[model samples]
Structures are given as C-alpha cells and as structure tokens.
Target: MKLSILALASTSVIAISTAAIGQEQDEELRFGLGGAVVTQDEGYKDVGSETQFVPAIAIEYGDFRLLGPYASYTFFKTDSFELAATGMLRLDGYEQADGDIFKGMEDRDMSFDFGLEAEIDTDFGEFGLKYTQDVTNTHEGYEATLSYGLPITVEKGRIVPYIAASYASEDLTNYYYGVKANEATADRTFYQVDSATNFEVGVSSDWFFGQNHMIKADISYTSFDSSIKDSPLVDKSGTFQVLLGYVYVF
Candidate 1:
C-alpha cells in the first residue's frame, strides 16, 4: 500500500537508534511499543506533517543488530571497529493519492537497500559509514552516508547529537524527484535530477527510569542540494523531522 509518511517516521527512529550505537544495549532482548510525531516536506508541493506508532527494538543476538526497521549483521569486529552487512527499507517516493502534483505521475514504489556498514567507537565520538544500493530495484540507485555522534550523559539518560552527509546517486534522485517527458504535463514540465549530496544534523535522547521505563526523542533537519531542489516535483529546499516516543524495556 502507501508507505509514505509513516515510513519516513520509522526511518527517523532508525536514525536515532543507529546514532546511539556506542551505548550499551540489553544483550538478550529489548523491545517495546511507542508512537512518533514527524514533520517533513520532502520538497513536495502540498504535503506536510504526519505521525504513527512504531516499534522500539534494540536486540543484539550474536553479530546481528535490530533497530526498529533497520537491521545489520556484523561479520567482523575489533575492540573499537566493526564492519557489517546492512539492510533496511527505503521508505521514500510518493503515491498518486498523496498530492495533486502526482495525479499525472506514476506511483514510485518503496524499496529495500542492502550494503555494507563500518563503524568506529572511540574516546572522542562514534563514526559511522554506510554504502547501500536498492536491492528491490524500485529506484535502481545507490547511496553512501558518513556520520559522527558524541554521547553525553545527563541525570538518568544519554543525549546524543549527530551530523551526517549523504550522497544520492542520479538514478535514485531522478526516480523520486524528477519528472519524465511521458509523465509531464503543461503544468509540470520534464525535469531530470542529477547526483547530489545532502547534509543533516540531529539530536537524540533516551531517558531511563525504574529500569523499564524509557523515553526517546529526536529532532533532525536535512538540507537538500540543487539536484532535489530544482526538481519539478519539489517545492522546498529542506525538511525538518521530529520524533518523540516511549518504550518499555523488558
């Protein structure tokens, strides 16, 4: 069906959880339920903010790690460095029912990505790198990201602020943002998207109380380059996302 905004919210949860990789997790299992409120533009003409409930999962079984919809398997690890095979759902693109701009446009489908990830946890901060391609072929594109996060301890929890840069392949950008000649109309002219990079900054926090009660939240903003900003399907240059959720640790 339509994975639209809900998928984006879930991705935000994934980002927050992934950024907290240096923190300790429950070895056996950590699962709970929570809801998040997300606001994003994606540069679409009329679409705005949205929300839904999502799972809170932090399970480390052997070399595998699960964070909400994001999953990874570590094949190699050292005291401070690890390399893993990663896979996650790419919940992007649009449905015709989403906005009027998509009336004459074909529905872009959601796809899955598979790739490799490397991470390093040091005294200063945690650094992460990932490279993924669309295995489902919905976009036939690839992406790479580099991120850094530093954790700070508060009274009963940890606050982490991270910055990341992502490079989007032309195939991926065009599939989601560009309008083709066959799908173009008088109101929407043909446009082709080129490869570009996006920058993001965000902060996440996890507060624990009574051993089982946990509160999680994150706020992030992404700035799009001309490759996406110049698209006929997009109207803005950036988008902001906010998530607030609670999970009970078992």
Candidate 2:
C-alpha cells in the first residue's frame, strides 16, 4: 500500500477544500507549522471514537499548495472561477492489526488518487466539483464529489459552513467495507458493497492575531449511505471528526 505523506487534517481533505482553489495573490511562497488532532467514529463495529495528533505542515508557492495528505496546483483562474489539478491519499482501509473484527479479512490497501477540480465563487457561496480515480489498482475505482461552502468574514478572520456529497464506485466501497466469501466467519458474513453516496456537513473557523499567528478549528459530521451501513463491519450510521490547530504564517 502507498503511504500517505501526512494525516494532519480531515481525512476528507477539506482543510484545503474550502474553495478547492488557492487564493489569488502575487507569486510567493508561504509556510506554516503546527499540530492538529482528529477524533472520529466511522461505523466500524468494534472501533470506538479514534483520536490522533498530527503535525500540521502547510506550504503554498506560486500556484501550488500542499496541506497534509492533499496537494493541488492551480493552472487556471478568474475573478470568480478557478480550475486545478489535485491529488490525495486514500486512508480509508484497515489492517488486521487494527482490530479483531478484521482478524481474518484481507488487508485493504491504501492508494494515491489524482484528479482535476473546479471551483466557482458567487455571492451566495462557493461550489467545488471534483472527479478522482485511484491510480493504483488497489481498489481500481473512481469517485466524484460536489461541495458547497459559505464563507462569512468575521473579526480578523473567516468562518465557513459547508456541505458536501461524494459518490463512490462499487470497487472503492467494497474494498473498504466488503466481506469476502473466504474471509467470512461465523459472525461475519460475505457481503459486497455497491456504489454509495455519503453526505457531510461542517463548519470551519480561523482566527488571526499578531500579524502572523493563526488558529483554526473545524468540526464535521458524515452520514454514510445504506450500502455502507449494511456492512457487518460497520455498526454506526454516521461519523464525526474534529480538527484544531495553531500556526505562524511566514
């Protein structure tokens, strides 16, 4: 399985997803460092709310940006529209070492995904569209996502409330949640997952101070579709993840 460079932000990669487009500024390099934590409970039968601390390292140079496991390069832009090439790592699968529920299950490997994304900003809000495919045959699948966010300028910073939906292919869904015939046990049944759509609602905020210091926090809830919920491996219907961090812009 391919390793993800970082897990500093939301596994959904929305830290860099607000506009899905980089800010329009003079060609310059920007960097920040901090630490973040995430807490999640995503339907895994035996898994409780899993939390972890990750170092946050973000870099933006000219038309390129890198944050955690997500990276993008903006090649086209306009006053209210922009397009970019993006990539991220798939960290959805689990290993046997993770828990007994996966004791005899074949390991579902992670993969790198690459795609093109477009963003549109209007008085009402921002809209982002993306289509990605797993380059590695690990899952041999593709997915598409559509998201909307409303940015409310606040004191010295901004807050964004957003909603997003992603459609995953059968291959992708099955790879992460399916139970194979040979892998099934007395308690686990052989199950196959079809294409599924998941929905998410989130709010993210940022506070700026002392010229270069910034603090950020984000919270989100994701609802899985029936296709995934029916999996014996899953026990919950939804999941929540939270992220908070501080950094000095330089």
Candidate 3:
C-alpha cells in the first residue's frame, strides 16, 4: 500500500511539471526595432515627397502588442491559432519645397486606427489577415493587410530579417492625404485623392552589446501610390525615407 501511494504521487508531479514546460514554450515576448526609407507617389508636388526617416519600436508579450504610446492591442491564442484587437493614433507634419504646388501651405496630418486580426499556423509558417478602420478626420477609411512569416536562414548573429507588404484603396489613401473641403485652406484647392498601393520589404536585427543594453537596425522601402501626384500634398513621382536609431531595453 505504501509503495503504491508513493508511485501515484510521483506520477502526478511529473505530469504537472510537463504541463508547465509546455505552456512556457507556447508564448514569447519578442522585442525588435525597425527602420525604413519611405517614398510617396506623385501629385504632392507642393510637399515634394522627400526622403524622410522613420524609427519604430515594437513589443509582443503574450497576447498583447504595443508600439510607441500610440498603438496597443490584445491577442488571443489557441493551439496554433491567434486573434487580436488593435487601436492606434498618430500625428505628423511636413515641410514643402520651393516651386512645389502646395509650397506656400504647411503640411500637417493626423490619423487614428482601430481593428481586428485573425491568424493561422501553417507548416511553412504563420499567416494572418488584418482589418483597420480610420477614426480621425485626417483618415476616415478602412484598410487591410495579408501577412506571412517564415524562417529564411539559421545563422549565428544578433540580427534576423523578414519582409511584409500591404494593399490600400482610394478611401484609405485619401483619408491620410485628402483633406475635406472645409478642412482645406481658402487658397488651396480641395484636391481629390486617387487610389494607390504600397509595397515594403525590409530586414531587422538585434545587437546584444551587453547586459540591459542593446542596439537594433531596420531598413526598408515603402512606395506610396496616390492621385494627389501633381497636387499640393506630395511630389510628382513619390517619396522615399531612411531611418536609423538606437534603444535600451530594461
């Protein structure tokens, strides 16, 4: 009787320990830095789509992801499934070059986004679909993205790379650029925003210089397609940008 009781206790402990280990590996917190060179298409001659710098930080903990102070979302998890809810807000201003269409006017824009996501786990990797709704007057439209993730190489280093792309429509592009009639100044024309899409490919890496201190680099190209091509908001062709920065994770 004594031997049987001891055996039963040992089995239960082993089962509990195994369950805990499995759960630990199911979720992870992945922190990374991203940089990109973004270019906007023509029609914004006044804004002269110049090369601007973009720096960003992202943190993923369990089912929650946070970007700067503007975007936050909660995620759901299944055996190999995922879902999420997201919200975002941002403000931006641009300077125009001389001889540009909207040269005399200042370029200022603000936008807000709220959305949901669904993802599936595949043998190749993780695939996801996302939908976002613009809430602010600066951008009042809907957009979506189909994303995928796959491991390219196994190497010894601090940097790992990946690629992503998104497709947007007229409503989405205009919301970000097409100012309403009342929104535009007296001298400026109510330029209509045309349909456009953006394609982006980039790589990201993490450098562990020391304990509690690290460096990161993200570089990519974003091409914007919009009807405001010859308008006052942007250049005739498009705009490009390159961003570089550093961070400390505690």
Clashes of each: 0, 0, 21
Please list the residue runs of candidate 2 whose C-alpha ends up more than 4 Å from where it truly belongs after superposition: 1-25
lDDT at residue 165 of model 3 (Cα atoms): 57
Model with the higher lDDT, candidate 1 or 3: 1
lDDT of 2 by residue, 54-161 (tens): 666677778787766778899999999999998987776778887789998888888889999999999999999999999988899999999999999988778999
TM-scores, all models, native as reference: 0.89, 0.91, 0.61
Model 1 misplacement above 4 A = 1-4, 11-30, 55-59
Candidate 1 at residue 204, lDDT? 79
How well does candidate 3 match the true structure in TM-score terms?
Answer: 0.61
User: Which digits, one per residue and each the tens of the lDDT, describe model 1 over residues 1-250?
Assistant: 2365566566555444443443445354434445565555566876665555655555555567676667888899999999999998887877789899899789898889999999999999999999999998799999999999998999978899999999999999899989989998988999999998999999978777765566778788899988889887777888777777665544
- Compute the lDDT of residue 53 as modeled in candidate 2: 66
Judge candidate 1 at residue 212 and give its lDDT. 56
Q: Regarding TM-score, does 2 or 3 come out ahead?
A: 2
Between candidates 1 and 2, name the one with more favorable lDDT. 2
Clashing pairs in 2: none
Candidate 1 clashing pairs, residues 3+ apart or interchain: none
Residue 63's C-alpha lDDT in candidate 2?
78
lDDT of 3 at 228: 41
